[model samples]
Target chain A: MNDTTPNSYRTGPDERGRFGIFGGRFVSETLMPLILDLEAEYEKAKTDPGFWAEMDDLWTHYVGRPSPLYYAERLTEELGGAKIYMKRDELNHTGAHKINNVLGQILLARRMGKTRIIAETGAGQHGVATATVCARFGLECIVFMGATDVERQKPNVFRMKLLGAKVVPVTSGRATLKDAMNEALRDWVTNVENTFYCIGTVAGPHPYPAMVRDFQSIIGKETRAQMMEREGRLPDTLVACIGGGSNAMGLFHPFLDDPEVRIIGVEAGGHGVDDRMEHAASLTGGRPGVLHGNRTYLLQDADGQILEGHSISAGLDYPGIGPEHSWLHDMGRVEYVSVTDDEALAAFQLSCRTEGIIPALEPSHALAHVAKLAPTLPRENLLVMNMCGRGDKDIFTVAEALGSKI
Target chain B: MSRIDAKFAALKAEGKAAFVSFVMAGDPDYETSLAIVKGLPAAGVDVIELGMPFTDPMADGPAIQLAGQRALAGGMTLGRVLEMVRSFRVDDQTTPIILMGYYNPIYSMGVERFVAAAKDAGVDGLIVVDLPPEEDDELCLPANAAGLNFIRLATPTTDDTRLPAVARNTSGFVYYVSITGITGAASASAARVAPEVDRVRKATGLPVCVGFGVKTPEASAEIAGVADGVVVGSAIIERIAAGEDTASVLAFVKSLTEAAHGA
Candidate 1:
């Protein structure tokens, strides 16, 4: 693998949708035409001002975008090092960064005349966002959630149900995000005529990793402007949690070429990144293998059977990272680290007490990394971490972890 | 000619469709699965599609999925699957053995090494469900280069514009998915599949084998009459899942093969 830096890292996933050797359209013949059609539509949408106008309008009004990049005064003082700023994407409608990509795909689906929207969710944040959009548009929504996740993320399941979406609990494999995605793909192959699969993360086939990254780039685009406004320059560092790495990709893509802005992505280190295979840190512990229509870093056995990844955060429980992140990791452009579940739980409480922001466990993994890094860095270092999700849905899980009654 | 092409040619000469049976390697247990596989040829099977068990089989239904789980639980690995093929080849060389599964396993064992090992283990063809024509360079070209037939599937969604692409690097028989859904979800109608089989055969100029929903002997006969071959996977797997002894499973397979050959 070549570690030489490219002139520009953003022009990736060439015509065949490959980010180096990571991403490609590795789907069945049944879904090839639909994927190709979707790609063509997305290419057209990229050039259409009308599409962006609609997206901008929806972002401003419905999703409440240009989400505030709040200075973490108390948290910074506690760390006594870098000035911390949180890009408050958890404040978006449906309470996560997932809606940013959901809206983009839903609009494209509308353009393509698809009325039935299907999605696979891990933490149910993506399901809620997809359900919310489908309700607003009166589109039929079906969310495939891991049966295990459905139990843990009960509140988000109810939120999706209240939004009129049918939540199908998948019981395949380890019954987690990967299995849910498998079920969703099966549904797409079965219902090729009218269904639009709104993938929740920056994984999956070619156009998906790229398309989701483009839509979620709004976070980084806004952050670039917001940081310039607040600090009179770009932030010195950026950090975000990665399940499929959508939020991290969103916040990091715009800064990839900047060279000076250090970027870090935290993966769920369930117990640890040791040989136990009890972690969701794909780039850190896994190797390249194909799953869910793309070749990326996958936690698989020596025989190539995908291993079930463990994580306290349901959203960070996936066994693979985005293909682009794999490419970026290979290129040495982004530093990928992992935090254990115990560390993340502590970070969750710290964020709640110090910053007065109850962070979702997904981004709590990121905050845990920030906590470790902030204390060592100089106070002048401007560190921006993506608060990609709110914690209301996770209060139960957190309380249980804390051994306290909710 | 490759074993797959030779078998198809022989079947064409006999004016009979090939009876292709799929079973997960090492399902239930390695010994029982091996016994069942060895019995397939005498039971009238023409081609064998040995499933290389994968952890995530998105295209498969409950029956095949459970079969894979059983196989994995029995400690089935890619190396062991190849060993099973090698064992099968010890007695039967005429029957085409195709390793059917996702790309990750073969990819995990490196494409070049896998293609070499599969070829060495007497694998005649491959049906990796996830690898479409767009990503043919990953495994298809290499496997084809190593004298193995890299088969491709042509689904109902594969339209006129996409048929040529799907068939371009394809060897062996083109698998025509009889339904739009995963395996074992629905039964296929020959009336519905016949025209689609004709389209794929014409486009690819190769034999078309219909699969995905062929469940019963009658269903197998109906589909065989329309296409060059009939593949029964989940149905055979269901019998295995039911814990039928190797002999009983072979008896069931023989019945399905008889219907296809008699068609």
Candidate 2:
């Protein structure tokens, strides 16, 4: 063990890409050099003012930056306790917070002279976002999605096709997010000459978790500033749903050093985080194991064979959580919880009926936890939940789940 | 010296390149898989690469991936894989057995415990595809400390500047991945792999074994001409997937080994 723990949680992932033995570059030798090159380029871009200048311009003009942090009056009134607010990242160009990280990675890819882009998606939100950006840059794009996801998320598949991306349906493993990522890694290893793998979540190898977190920190940064302007103080609590935990990491990373602010990450509880292994809550139900190039909490059998995670929301069906989330969970810096599918469904309906806003089932999990936790807190306690995605793409699934045919 | 080193030295003395064959333990079933492994040495294999099946084999193509699935479906586990090695050791002591796969199973089993178990089970070396030199401390160093060779792979993407790090702390012979892609995706051209094998051998001062996409006896011979050893995995697993009996699989491996040894 290193024995030396840093005082600040923000300055993690020491030079070796490790977040306290959680995240490291555990990739095949075939992609090591490329990962190193990317790390080097990202290091240079971190200090280059011109790089941030381009990112700022795109985030402002193209992505519609400063996504509103709106006061959820109806939700707060219904909960009968802590005031509620929703960070409106679902209003971004691609209708999800995934675009924020996609833009940053695409810009870096262009700087690296990579012309082909590859990505893996679960619910197709990230695919749509990546395809949209690739279309804007006129770069070749390919998205790997599980066949199961392709069948369910046909609309996003069509959208990606319309955006000129080739979507390959992976049929391996449980045919979900994990398999899609495997296929994408295979593509990346094969096409290392000119390909750039734009990972969707805060998972995968080292720089990716850190890079995606840095890009998505815009959510929390905006939330911090907006809360100050609206409430005259930082929110008492922060909540976000975690599949690969990108959105939660985004909203929580900027507030990690704020000891007064309580952080919570809600993971998908498919049936329940029980012995049956039906949930996507890695931190709550799983143990530390290496997969997809990093060591993190994963749903695996005793033999270390990764188990297929189930969730009503396709976006939250991954079997692993991001490394930083694992590190934070170990350090007790953040509280990790799980909400069942039924609870998330109830929250989804509640959000539509009360707030006049339809939330993707991924965030509905967070909303479910919020509904439970809000009533227990005092009236003056302020709570902020990330409305990370819109439910426009999930209407059919929601309709089917609610026993109403679309 | 380890069995791997002794086997390589014996091959060098015989003026022959070593032929390494890979098969997933418990593929189809335990008994048949053990039968195939036991038949490897008599079929002229100098080294054996026993695949510890994983759920997601990101570096593998369809053949090896299917083999892993079949093994997993047949109830293969880290313990069972180690048990298979122990069973193989009861009869064969001269042939080097190297366990190859992802890191999770061993990690789940606990690295130190897994290393000790692997050494006790007659596992002479390890070739974890995902563990680059950057993660040597995780398993490589421990395996090395436990007297097991932790082999490292040098790929086409592993350029001259990065060769030193890959070669450092590498105890066994270096594995030179002949292609930039996954296993069994494309055929490796000797013309393309010869210079790379030479580069890795020079950097590591270890015998170089070329693998990935070496499918046929002819290709095996071609690769063997340029490196000290040639590894054929997917091709052997393909025969197993095709439901060829142990004798047929052993015959197929014999042809490749004969070609490699002849070269």
Candidate 3:
């Protein structure tokens, strides 16, 4: 009842603890008081130089920050686009941008003096990322993944297990990303004292979306610096795939201020937007509502019921996008679009065939757009897309989709 | 005044929140859900949310989803939910009724036809979990104009950046999720819900009713003392799932409502 409108989220856990409309303590009642406690504790930890030193030391030794930005010489020539360079986040220690966020959260968790780590995974990318970090930091890690996703993304599932993390397959709902998140939230609410919910994407309640975005913003920072060094100026266009939209926002965020930079986000079209089996493209087809935390676009129905979305790629099967993406789409700062299953598959195969880089299905959706949009733009125009993750875990899906001959 | 707005305005003028409960229209059996519906008002429930059975409920937790499945299993359809609402309205003229469910069935039923059916059902409001606020350009505008209050769930994640827009479309009470997760999880706590209620109240003038983790009389009582209204779902469904009789469930809820009112 107090005017939480302004001080709801302070830039740094605020007076009442909120972060610029993005981070607030929007947890369960059981978890709320705990979060307030954690927020207080986190504030103390953040102020301690020992915490920063520990994070910096781990940043260098454990999860390899300052990941190199590699110029895709071969891809650029083949695609014939304006100097298409990758942020090389796919080369990060965990082979994806997921770690950038998890590493920070895990480190923050440790700083908060939490002994256990919990997270949810859609394609097991975030699970593997969280598991990998927990192993290094010596934190007890538990991951919740949808049962169906566990079966499909077997390699990543096994990888989480190998990394010494317990994987709890959520069997609720469609048993996908959203369900896994529900389980993770449930875990956090129950074990708020000893546990930390390392959100996989920039989509959860306050503090989470903002914190994850800040952690992942390294992608944007690196891209901006690398692009300036090579092109002497910012690129004209930017594109990234969006499930929960961390990678997209991470890449587009820093460049948001750049007027010349045309930002684009690609969503999974599943069979196609027209098909019932389409990915949850909230902007093009979805409406705004509140889910996880802040209000953004959600794939709900007439009665405001969240509907399960279908996507061929497990990575982009979620029903909501990140809050920042919602703002960008509404402001018309970003052009939000989608690509179909067949097109993304073709692009996934094309990236492998032409550029020798097998991209994740998520980025492949972006690739599909890149492939279509690249050749059309003049050689002077530049197009850069965040290759959020490597395609190592997508072999089975790609092979099956390509009609693997036994 | 619109049916829902008028009911809530009266409640608000009296300084009370509406306790809304949702169940699959044909959960277990059409007649059983019907009996529960008619039985709810006297049980101290202010509003009843009828979930139209569908094949998929993405936002629903295992409990509501299974309830939907059971309703579907018992040959529940959109039409049946409508019939139940119509029948419930015969005696329950004072209490408001809202249909909360997914959109595919209504989309399949045709938005115009569904709106007409809802109006005919004496339905007061709606809370379509899957219907995005953006898509309301097509659905909610019509639902609002047709004298239906389309309630939306505003969560902790929906910060000020997006809260204004989501709140703009809301006509009925805002269903504030107490957790960052799904419905029916035993994770939500009053400690977590209070700030959210505080946040949601800041976002809109609409009454804020918190749901998701409320499973006990103590929990509902605790939340009700703070929030404008308290929504208890999974606990009720869990009882139904566990084969608890409806009569006891209603009695338990009525007493819980009293507890919530600080009785």
Q: What DockQ values do the models have? A: 0.90, 0.88, 0.08
**How far out, in Å, is residue B190 in model 2?**
1.1
TM-score of 2: 0.99
Q: Tell me the deviation in Å of residue B147 in model 2.
A: 0.9
Q: Model 2 off-target regions past 4 Å?
A: A1-6
Tell me which residue pairs clash in candidate 1.
Answer: none
**Candidate 1 or 3, higher DockQ?**
1
Weakest 10 consecutive residues of candidate 3 chain A by summed lDDT = A1-10
Q: Where does the lowest 10-residue lDDT sum fall in candidate 3 chain B?
A: B130-139
Predicted candidate 2 versus true structure: per-residue lDDT over B44-149, tens digit per residue: 9999999999999999998989999999998889899999999999999899999999999999999989999999999999999999998989999999999999
lDDT at position B83, candidate 1: 96
Provide the global lDDT of candidate 3 against the true structure.
0.76
Off by over 4 Å in 1: none
Return the top candidate by DockQ: 1
Better of 2 and 3 by DockQ: 2
Candidate order by DockQ, decreasing, is 1, 2, 3
A50-164: candidate 3 lDDT, tens digit per residue: 8668766766676676666666667677777666766667777888889888877877787677899998888888889999999987889999999999888888988999999
Docking tier of model 3: it is incorrect
Per-residue lDDT value at B122 in model 3:
95
